[model samples]
Target: MALMITDECINCDVCEPECPNNAISQGAEIYEIDPNKCTECVGHYDEPQCQQVCPVDCIPLNPDRVESKDQLMDKFLKLTAQKS
Candidate 1:
């Protein structure tokens, strides 16, 4: 599943840089995660980097964008291909 930044986000700016997919961005109110770009760091790390760095613990799996590990890996491969 993709990750989401809830209203609990403090916007301390730590999570943005930690996202390998660059999915985290400053929204009108709080940081937002683009489900299309979010792979939950499946190909890049053992855990979601943003969630690890977020001080407020606002980052959570997005229920609306749930996916299996294989699906996430597929998304990661697609994103990786696009970069090249």
Candidate 2:
């Protein structure tokens, strides 16, 4: 599953740089995680970097946004398509 930032988010900006996929970004209301770009760090780390670095534990698994490992891998490939 991909992690999502809730309204509880302080806009602390703590989770932004921690995302390996660059999936987290400031949104109109709060920081938002792009499901298409999120990989939960599958290709880059042992865990989701944003959730790992979030001080408020605002990043949580999104059941509705769930994806299988293969799906996440596909998303990962799309995210790092250039992989330069």
Which candidate's lDDT is highest? Answer: 1
1-84 in candidate 1: lDDT tens per residue?
998989998889999998889998899998999999999999999999998998889998999998999999999999999999
Q: Which ten residues in a row have the lowest lDDT in candidate 1?
A: 2-11
List the RMSD of every prediction in angstroms: 0.5, 1.3
Q: What would the TM-scores of all predictions be? A: 0.98, 0.89
* lDDT (10s digit) by residue, model 2, range 1-84: 787888889898888898888888899989999887888998888888888778888889988897998888888887788665
Query: What is the clash count of model 1?
Result: 0
lDDT of 2: 0.86
Q: How close is candidate 1 to the true structure, as a TM-score?
A: 0.98
Where does candidate 2 have its weakest 10-residue lDDT segment? 75-84
Indicate the residue-level lDDT of 67 in model 2: 91
